[model samples]
Target: MALKAAGGHGGNVHAAARDLRRPIESLLDFSASVNPLGPSPNVLRALDEGMRLIRHYPDPDSVRLRLILASRWKLAPEQFVIANGSTELIDLIPRALGIRSALIVGPTFSEYGSALHRAGAKDRHVRAARQDGYRPPLEEVVDCFRSGRKNGRRPEAVFLCNPNSPTGQACDQNGLTRLLKEVDRFGAWMVLDETFVEYCHELSQLPSVSRYPRLIVLRSFTKFYALPGLRIGYSVSSARTAALLRQYQPPWSVNVLAQRAAEAAIRDQIHARRSRAYLRRERHRFAKALSSLPGLRLFPSRANFLLLELPKPCRAGAVAAELGRRGLLIRDCSLVPGLTPRTIRVAVRSRNDNNRLVAALAKLLR
Candidate 1:
């Protein structure tokens, strides 16, 4: 059994964010997943203006941003609840639901478990076999819940990642809806993390949520909008579920600038369209580049990031350390079980940068 220590290292992103405060020009961070062509021109300009409003209490409601989101999504503004970041929202679900027990997709973003741990919940794993392309058997996942229930393990929370982390496979829409309905029958709250869904293009996200009160769809501007530092994301649920979450939402939870930037981003269809086009083209190109490199195992991915399983009997940590020394950073997946040090996750960056990574790996392996 691989040791699952305190997992959420927060990636190099937390480090980069910390380092940025001290002033630096460029940092090659394929460690964090965000849209390479994000925080569009319009939002950058709007942020310049919104920066001045830092003096007043940001509208506690984050009304404008929600309005824009609602308009684009064609949902009621009241249906959207913003947060510090999707992370905050993820953490909140485990909190607000009063769920003392949960299950998460293994080798996924560790924060899901970290949040459950902080909330004093028992976190169980339905490991996604790496050889299986890290695709959890949805049927098995559902069965885990059913069997657990029969065994008196009525877990209240099931956290899912669409275009899931570390391993980029996504459950089809029908599969997700079916899974949700099964879990709902058991009275569990299904938290769907769609942080990478933007990269999936036309994959349908209309969750069982529209008809079921137990489903919640979580999205973040951090990924596709390329605004991780701005810290903005929202949740979609039935009116009742939205209201329940609204009651717990912190006043002015989203700051003035993040709100303005997110509102502007949610409304900028051009940026959204262009980023999708770029990722669709670039992800395939990058994947092909990585596959041709010796000793690298590439998996199928429909997202902006690629989860790579490196040569066996190796420590991914060492690869990461070597890359970091060369000013290039990627995710070392050794900490997550069912994944080994031979596993690394890299984001699809600008074409030149992606080539640089491919070149770096080639040279290192040689």
Candidate 2:
């Protein structure tokens, strides 16, 4: 079977396990790029304590979690809009802002395009070239905003994912700052998705979004906090934009356990620090190991995953299938725009798991 699209996003081991009639844990999943160190103990303890609270509805506004985020970021609580996931906020933006046209930087997250489509908005994609290592052209985007495309009006909004998915490329702070100024000049909204920014904290633009009236910064606890199942995420923007987004979001979109878990997760500075340090060390080692494998070109990544260009004569789908049958699941990039049939993505996992993946590829590729 063809690998499901969206790079077979992490936590898909269940469906594959069911088909193989094996336990999920038996399958080594490297498709999703969650923290290999896993969730903080404090987060798990918070979840256990929150079990009793499930009988009651979650606070419709997620005031407590918002307060934690506000304190951490030094932003007013009014600047926040917590959501079930950043995906919810992505879909809500076009409708909430009544945007008719939007430009998306890609090949990045597929959800941005799908969400805009659902809002009945025009989607314009400017793909980053492989020759450029998939870095988005900030100058070109500024020009697009300043001068409307030949066939259409200027986009009312633009979407960008930092340390972008699938490709694992990110724009530096200087470049992003310049792009924001251009977006401001055009009087359009800029949506910066920083879901993977925790891994590369220095590059995050979270601190400046509140100052930019037309900029919205999206973040998630799923990857960094290892809370994908909880689906906790939020956005930071001007108070007016936050309020508008709130009006469009369903009440209690964030659940009781998720709120409690995230509340505890954010307080564990030790866990966050340790995770950062570990990822830095392990990602380098893992990337080096992947490099030694024949016919695989590993792309530079600041996130928890690496995108690999498979050797010629190797197809992503075929490789994904071969590895899947051996209980190792990876992302096949055939459907991800701007990628070739030989591209595949694998998450940076534990040393043992990473070695197993390398060995599996060694055997397959040889």
Candidate 3:
């Protein structure tokens, strides 16, 4: 079911339209789950202001941006580690902690496997069943962790993709808390990737990072703030863990423009409220519409995207290609580990775009 070498993290407008002879602007991308509304006006102003500082080296420490994030979370600046993107910090975690083996809950983002492998760690991917709507069961994960220790060895790290990618299911906080304590007993780290948690802030464990020394929470501005091009994300952990993550990072990993953009983006309360409100209303409307489509099984999601499993006779890659020819790009989830060829993922976008996508999908299904 692995359709291509690159795993199913979509939003590849450039590559999708490259050989189609179609303009990128003409493509309606329901592939990448990013905010349909923005690079906030606040971000635009910050980017413009950052232009004057391009000639100077960015502050390697990212002090100003960290301060802003700290204020929002009510945590000290030392508890946060800024990076080029969450990917950088993801890779850093295994290396910084000298992790030898790890457990990853899948099928979720491929980067966790790739990053851990690159850090020279052996990672066992435990699949979360589709029958359960792709949500990883906490009891199963705890059992696996405990069972592995019976061999006189245990994984040094465990990764959880909150509101997991490809399948937008998340673990309950109390369950996660109990699991965190279990991991603590074995002296292992729990890497909680909440990249899309901003869309559902009430589910976030970001505030608990200070309480759990073994927890490392990864967050990004790329999806929520629409600053993917700028590439700025940060990690939240205890001050000591944050320092270790920072130590391994190259100098000035966050550029001037990215830092400025994040600073402004975090402070844009008006846009944040609007984005959340819009996502809530539109996600419900879109989900209802999608549910009415024949032969499609839509998984529950709290993030700004939905995971769809098509009828048995259909395949996602083929459907994706058909939609692509019509300037609609979607993610074929067949390649993502733990998923079948019938699965595909699409972003929750604007009303018009969502309707267009539904129309296109409906026509193709017919």
Give the clash total for candidate 1.
2
The lDDT of each candidate is: 0.79, 0.88, 0.87
Per-residue lDDT, model 2, residue 268, is 98
Residue 155 lDDT, candidate 1, scale 0-100: 75
TM-score of each candidate? 0.93, 0.97, 0.97
Find the candidate with the highest lDDT and give its number: 2
- Assess candidate 1 and give its TM-score to the true structure: 0.93
Which portions of model 1 miss their true places by more than 4 Å?
Answer: 1-6, 10-23
RMSD from true fold, candidate 2: 1.5
Report the lDDT tens digits of candidate 2 across residue range 37-154.
Answer: 9999999999999999999999999999889999999999999999998989998999999988889988888888888889898898888888888777777787787678564578
lDDT of 3 by residue, 26-87 (tens): 98888888999977898898889899999999999999988989989999999999999898
Worst window of 10 by summed lDDT in candidate 3? 1-10
User: Candidate 2: TM-score?
Assistant: 0.97
Q: Which whole-number lDDT from 0 to 100 does residue 109 have in model 1?
A: 80
lDDT of 1 by residue, 263-345 (tens): 78877888899999999899999999999987889988878889887776557777776776666768777776777757788
- Residue 86, model 2: Cα distance from true site in angstroms: 0.9
| Higher-scoring candidate on lDDT, 2 or 3 | 2
